[model samples]
Target: MSRERRLTAGAVAVLLVALLGVAVVPGVLADPSADGPVRPGRVSIAESPAIAPEEVDGATATLRLHTRIGHAGNPTDNVSVRFRAYDAESGLLTAERTVELEELTGDRSVPVNATIEVPREGGYVIETVVFRDGRVVDRDRTRVSGLAALGTEVHFTESEAVPPLSVSVASVDEEANRTTLTVAASLTNGGESASDRLRVEVVLRQAESNIVAARQSTTVSGIGPGRTADATVEVTVPSDYNYYVDAAVYRDGVLVDTARSVANLDPTETISANMTTREVEFEVSDFAGDDGSQEERATEAAARTETATATPGFGPAVAVAALAGAALLARRRTRQ
Candidate 1:
């Protein structure tokens, strides 16, 4: 080729790489949480959203799609969340629900679960959109299947109360470094009739050692539709030690539901059950295998990129640079 043609070709390749780099460098460097990339003025998802139904009844069932949202800025305000359910195969809208939120604080991520109803068959794509000031800031979607297999589950389930079941350390008495805890399990009946008698068991374990500190079980009364009931029990445990309050509900000799709470009495070492998992951005999931965390995968990708860039003759940029250099040298040789 002529020197002008060779020189022009090299310039074009260089320009292409520069443009591609401009489009990609920001995503590579941005700090992303489990849900998505956290940016100022942009509300990001915290982690993988879950679509679950406590029970399926008749032709349709009620389900919840939980999305955790947060931001890097000083907390978010005037947020409204819209939940949309689309048919997995047909891509048609099945159901939609919107819930108004007071605020999404920056200190911690908030789980905004949308209640939606759809036919108790086929798969669905559940999407959650976060809107601030009537404009969408962030959104996430995930596929859910096995709806046809979720047979008629127990009608009675835990109430909507946060941490449906909890154990609180009672300050009534303290002797020999021991304390009493009142464990309460909340139950709500969403069925058409009264619920069946169920059993709630509250077990406490040492936070660090996981030793059984105290355990008790109580019977929760059958509740009427839209009514809530609590089964309360008292247990004693060693003071100044953290404990995990594990509450489980059972009916007809079958375990139905469970909830967990943390009672951190150790003032020096407090903990929580809400340590949300931070996932790598743009992770792929098949809903079957546990191939490891998204964050780990992202880190591995970064490591590979760094290795390629540092080593010789590995990355595309290096190969492209070599090509451009050869073209330029060839053109210069023709001129000489």
Candidate 2:
């Protein structure tokens, strides 16, 4: 071949290789199966102004999605975004909706916009999937909280007379997701009708942010009247928690008494000051013997009389008792 022909062929080969590098390499890099750059086309989701359920009167939740898809190659139309809602059990309760982009210019990015409605109030998992060529390229999920029925007051039958209770939190266990709390409440009534349900409300507050993060309530059954009930409540607390607890005792929709406690969430093994556990003991009351109350009065009276008698002349009696005890000790020692 002539030298000029050979130079033309060399130029053609170089141009072909340059086109392959620009076109074929991008396809291989964008392929999800190839361990290529994980470019599921970038994703961004935003929700419009919707009132949170706890703060609003009407129970409605609306959200808008503004998604941007980037690095998608040419002929990238028919790429759709789909949304689905699932229950706590992962059951598919609703059908999925897909929104298509207007059109991809010869550029490498596409933008799709969508709006979705939240129908019910409960725990829900929201998911967004990006589809290309009838297959899911990438997906993302987020949890929505405080979605339970709002304005629905949980009332206690025996809680009418009792005010809102206060709670003191003692400790929080992050690994186990449990908060240990001490609750104390006063019950009024002379032992006739007692409070059956005692539930303490624990509010978790954020320390640095100084905001109320979460609230949970737990109940203990069967508390008697004219007495104070002291107990511990174990509840689930979210991560990054600063919280305290409050308690209320109720009977037949009437609140009778309340209390509060404080809690901390440091998870360190602690050695208690008490080396051994001690059992609590109480004086048994004799209801059958009418002298039970009288005996108590007589015991108190004798104690006071002894205290008064020992004031001045009682010193001599103590000395005599000490001498007698010493004499007995000396006699025993001699015998030994």
Candidate 3:
């Protein structure tokens, strides 16, 4: 052959060899593998609307996971799901099986099932990540709590430590046009661990009926082992009449205990309709103080003076006369 013809033939031969090598290569057209988190649109991860414990204990809990994987437009398949469980503080727990998978749906999706075991826990959070077409498509989390050991067993079971919580009219400050009452109650933790953020509620009920009159709540975060939390919460009752009050304690939104207080009405014989004013004495500790220190002399003097001035200063004679007049008025009203 001529030099030009030989050169053309060699070039064609090289081109043909390159094409043959490319054709002989392994299956490179296969789709990429799915892994990691699921991002919206890129892929869809459908997790159990709810995560729950089949059974729970200090050592382990079986958590059931329901999930789906898919893509928006294309029918996608072979999605990968990663599952994990952690304590309340978010420490990861080891799972017997870490991976789950589902086939692409007709609309491009699949379903995956997985079970997780919780080791030991104060609280546990379950997380799921769905991957579709080799990319993360969706993510979700669920929370579950373990039993905490508290001094008192209020929620775990019913017991007397669950003292009756109550509210009542302890006294009436006619001079101040206000009524004060003691909010007394007790709570015991009935758990293996201490409870935090314990809340107590006192409900003032309408006397002679079960209707709630007024509501008040108090909370103390720490209640330790075999311990009782006590307090005197006072509410100002505008009226001198008696009313029913109910009280209860709650832990983590659960009512653990409750109790009631005797309603102490104002002394009607001492309170007269004609006398528009009266005096009231509050405990020295009633005022807010860090160390329960007594109020300043000046403050006490001012409070007492204000109380004295509000009521008539009728000596023994006037008191006797007023008593007689009140008795007669009472008799007449009863007769009417």
Candidate 4:
């Protein structure tokens, strides 16, 4: 072959090798998954229209959250932005707002504002969530501090006789094993002003020793004046002791009032001494005396009080004994 023809054949071979290299190597020229140099859908939260690190309690403040969404490749549509403020310690939601946009062709900045009341002086968390097509695309959170300050306060005179907040142990249900107690508590806002972020706590404690056995808490939103709310809590406790159900009410993180009710679970009439076992056998007569007088029974019940290691089997046995004793006592009274 002539030199020029040979050179032409060499050039064709080099062109074929270059085409093969492009097919074998990925991302050599451009990324197929990405629309351009940047991602098609992007979201970010901005720290502008800044919130004060500390604010006065019981005051309302305007909170603004700024968000930026970018649609680089395809037109992102139907986007949502949400702002939520909550108590960082209690995890109670204080305020919330949402903004919706139809469609976005370029980068867009969306600003949302919410009026939040700082009920109590404490640390709080502000959160922002961005959603697209019902899916969360971005989330951000910041913290703020609430400071106590002198504000317009209302004082009720004793002569005025405003209804006072009250808490009561409505009912307590013992499990078959007696190891668990489900307590229903009722709270009433008797005062003239409304209460927000009210918390109710149920505690199971030994009557004589005042040792706490179990406790749980529940929260309620703003309770209007003269309104009532109910909450239930289940507590796991040690068995074979007389306990008292104590219900405590708090308004704006301050203790208001507390109520106590008796829970007699002692197998006093039948079991004279402490029994160290998974289960103890007792008779109904152990709780009552021969006279069966109300005062005598109370005295005997108090004298027989003893503390023993609680077991799963012991709770059911004690519960059974207590029920049987109550039924027998009622029957004897009827006979008289």
lDDT per residue (tens digit) for residues 213-260 in model 2? 445556665555454444444444443333444455433333434444
Candidate with maximal TM-score: 1
Error of 2 at 67 (Å): 2.8
In terms of TM-score, which candidate is stronger, 1 or 3?
1
The digit string of per-residue lDDT tens for model 1 on 293-325 reads 556766887899998789665779988999999
Least accurate 10 contiguous residues by lDDT in model 3: 285-294
lDDT of 4: 0.58
lDDT of 4 at 291: 38
Q: lDDT tens digits, residues 1-336, model 4?
A: 999999999999999998888899866667765655433456555443356423333344444444454444455776777778888889999887778876666565555444444555556787777788788977778787633312212121122232222222333324322355666565555657665575678787655555676778987655567666556677655455566677776555545556655555565622211322234343333222243444665676566663333344578789999999999999999999
C-alpha positional error of residue 281 in candidate 4 after TM-score superposition, expressed in Å: 48
Off by over 4 Å in 2: 1-60, 106-111, 149-336
User: Which scores better on lDDT, 1 or 4?
Assistant: 1
Rank ordering of all candidates by TM-score, starting from the highest: 1, 3, 2, 4
Backbone clashes in model 4: 3
Pick the lDDT winner: 1
Ranking by lDDT: 1, 3, 4, 2
lDDT of each: 0.71, 0.50, 0.58, 0.58
Model 3 scores a TM of: 0.33
